[model samples]
Target: MSNFVTLLVEDDALQREVLADVLKDEGFEVLECTTGEAAELIIASTGTELQALITDHNLAGKMSGTELAHFARDRHPHLNIVIMSGTTVKPMPVGTAFLQKPFSPERLLDMVRE
Candidate 1:
């Protein structure tokens, strides 16, 4: 199996695809989702294979990224979570990372590598 696995949850179709492409370019096995509900289901079923999660704060579904992050952290404590947002909201939990939107692909790659 590949050494890196990443899940990307973003509501914007273009952004999601762009991010997925970047991760793929870096040799990560990437799973993409546009909503928190779908993200939750994917994580539940594939948490063991997931090395990291990249999500946006706002999503198309009822649940937000923060909710998903908390759930994923509870279920998979060792997983790395990175939350992105255009506007600042609440502070993230310790050990979790944040990336502001309008970020360069290089910055995103750096964050994922970290």
Candidate 2:
């Protein structure tokens, strides 16, 4: 396994499982969660090990993915953050990437690899 830990936050069960499996297959150590709040806890505990964060924009908790992106970026400048959503996110966080819904796994992997 790779040391490049990635945190994936998605409320949808199937989406989270598939994405986590893909990342794992690509040799990334993926930490999966269903809500931004849970993701925040993971990031807080493993920020140093985390290389990337891929989160769905709208979550099932108080914090949204964009909010989580900002928080993670603020604490870990070297972290690569990607916000995925079916709709556009206005004024996306300065140092984060965006993936519109229905994007291919290849595209997502490319973003994370970059």
In the order shown, the candidates' Cα RMSDs to the true structure are 1.4, 1.0
Candidate 2's residue-wise lDDT over 5-87, tens digit each?
A: 99999999999999999999999999899988898888888747899999999999899999999989888888999999999
Q: Give me the runs in candidate 2 sitting further than 4 Å from their true place.
A: none
Q: Please report the candidate that would top lDDT against the real structure.
A: 2
TM-scores vs. true structure, each candidate: 0.93, 0.96
Task: Give the whole-model CA lDDT for all candidates, comma-separated.
Answer: 0.89, 0.92
Q: What are the per-residue Cα lDDT tens digits for candidate 1 across 1-114?
A: 266889999999999998999889888999899999999998888747798999999999899998899988988888989999998858686578899888999999888877
lDDT of 2: 0.92
Candidate 2 matches the true fold with a TM-score of: 0.96
Error of 2 at 1 (Å): 6.9
